[model samples]
Target: MQSEKLYSDLKPLLLSLAYHTLGSVTDAEDIVQEVFLTWEEKPPQQVRDVKSYLCRSVHNRCVDFIRSSSRKREAYVGTWLPEPVNTDKFQKNDPLAEMVWKESLSTAGLLLLQQLSATERIVFLLHEVFRYRFDEIAEIVDKSTANCRQIFHRAKKGIGPLPDRNPEIIEKKAAFAERFAEALTTGNIGLLIELLSSDTVLYTDGGGKVKAALRPIKGSEKIIRYFIGIKDEIPAGTRYETSEINGMPGIRLVVGEMIFAVITFHYLRDQLSDLFVVMNPDKLSHFNRMK
Candidate 1:
């Protein structure tokens, strides 16, 4: 019972760490459950800090998962995207809710994290997102504090700068979403092109499960043509809902009973900078189940 209570209390934090590190709700949940199941069998006594212990466990698990999953991703077809989470489904006090301001929770940020080596990624996440000290992270990853600091520095420099993710964009996002939907639905290619920045890019994560651009569709004209080509696949009655995805305003497209895609946007210099389209069925299942 004590172990159960502990598990219940720390589940959110565990999920927070795992999901941010792994970017898969399904895998995060599984790892948390596994941690709790092990604790239940061999409950610790007089633990100094439950949160720290759980975080260490989750951190190690995520590293192992990453090592194992990289090969799987190599075999995964097409462009891979991180699974989107309906942040509202999390408890108000959940770290995911608390950490909404952090770029690590955004889809674009997660994709950038994927570029790091497993060790660098974990070290950077521990220090940057969770606010852990280098010494503390060193203990978790079994590296010296100095080594962890070097890894964190390398990760930061390598990732460079990410795009903005401001909560203040709510009004602008709604306006853009409305216009985007109208242009796409009405087949207004010219209007769509006009709304996009000259160098705007479109990233589609189909995972080869469905039809998607294997590479990013760059330039306003190319993206316009890509959308015009696939407009028929959306059909007429597919439902579109504006909701907060990864803590920012976005649109979800549902076809029949299935979620077709989650579209998120980034703006720069007052124009749409990048467009993200997540269509991996595996990635969408957890999001759909939450809805």
Candidate 2:
């Protein structure tokens, strides 16, 4: 196949798979470019089953990246969050697109995927999201079909508590996020506590470079207080808006020329369950590019 045609045809699928699996647009784009380079350099006669070949290549690259990333994660300064990707450029313009987009890229779902081992994560993402059969995944991950099945099941069990990445919840979350921003901006502790679930957990990933909680802050009261305590320090020009983040309703903060932070809210039953605040500059470096 012509290199240009080949890349054009597979880039979207590869990007979607890579972004969904790794949750990093920079990494995904890099890996996809590498695949294109390799395809161009290889002899055409060696190529067969283009779809499978591309998928397997990207899959292996993502797994390798994840394995390496896990080590860095251990030494990571504070809470770690999946790198958020802007979906507007790539998501299909259609009615069901929102639902499909969330299923493919919800931050909460991606965070839950971290519970699984690398192998299990690969199996679950391939089998559950991409709809790849066990046999097909076996070739991609180089595991036996039976082993893949076991891993997928284990991944599911580990991720059991996470609610489904349902689009129907978007409406509720949108309201909750607006409420959250209002509370945080105005330092309304009572309303903040009221909006948050009793068991709500707040995770901040400052990557040790910024001042943030080193560990998760649990419960509604503590979380509300945590925000209220910092209200005075939030810089001038800081603005918060409800935006599509990681393919779901989330908050985007901007201060002056820089993109300050991206916060993904996880909610259940109209109550906010978890908040993932990604403040790591390294992680947010690519934020402006995507916007």
Candidate 3:
């Protein structure tokens, strides 16, 4: 009973760490569940700190999972994108809301995390996103405190600086999303072009399960044309609903009550920058609530 209570309380932090590290919601949940089972097998009294012990277990599992899945990731079709997790359901009292800033949960942010090696990713996330001290992270990663600091610094330099989380900037992003969605649904070509940056790019991930652009569509003009061309291709009953995906404003392309595609945008300054479209059925499976 004590173990169960501890697991329930720590589930949010565990999930946040795993999800941010792996960028896969499904796998994160699986890893956390595995950790819970392991916890159940051991007496809570045997653990020095339940939170630290569980976090270490999750981190180790993520490392193993990443090493094992590298081959599959390399062979993945087209551009591989992280599975988007809707954040609108997060309540004020949710632990995840405190553990991860909205910027850390952004799809763009997760993509940046992918550039990091497994150990670097875990160390960076622990220190940057979860605010763990070097000593705490050293113990979790089973490395010396100095080694962990070096790893964190290396990862930080690789990832550059974190995104701006100013409230005003956040509001601008929200407003931009609303305008962009209106322009898209209304087929306002002029407005769309004006909203997009000159070097705008669109990346689509279909996982070879469905048809999608095999390469990124670059330039504002090309992207505009692509959008125009696809306007007629949308299924008759398809409807779009704006929702918060991975902490950013995103659109869900639903056909007959099924969410088939998700679109997320990244900003360069105040202009609309990169756009990510996920049409892979496998990635969208976790969005069963859409039905």
Which candidate ranks first by lDDT, i.e. highest? Answer: 3
lDDT of 2 at 184: 77
What is the C-alpha lDDT profile of model 3 across 84-203, one tens digit per residue?
A: 877765634465554453545577778888888778888998888778899998888899999999999998887776666687876788788888878888899889988999999999
TM-score of 2: 0.88
Scored against the true structure, residue 258 in model 1 reaches a CA lDDT of 70
Error of 1 at 269 (Å): 2.7
Q: List the residue pairs that clash in candidate 2.
A: none
Candidate 2 segments exceeding 4 Å error: 92-102, 161-168
Instruction: Put down candidate 1 lDDT per residue, 1-291, tens digits, no spaces.
Output: 377677766776678678877888899999989988877788678667667777777877888899888899898777777888876555354554455334445677778888887678778877877688998888777889999999999988876655445556657776787788778778887779778987999999999888889989899989998998898787568878776677666788987777789998775656777889999888998888877
Error of 2 at 232 (Å): 1.8
lDDT of 1 at 235: 56
What is the TM-score of candidate 3?
Answer: 0.92
TM-score of each model, paired residue for residue: 0.88, 0.88, 0.92
Instruction: Tell me the spans in candidate 1 whose CA falls farther than 4 Å from its real position.
Output: 44-47, 91-104, 160-167
Query: By TM-score, is 1 or 3 better?
Result: 3
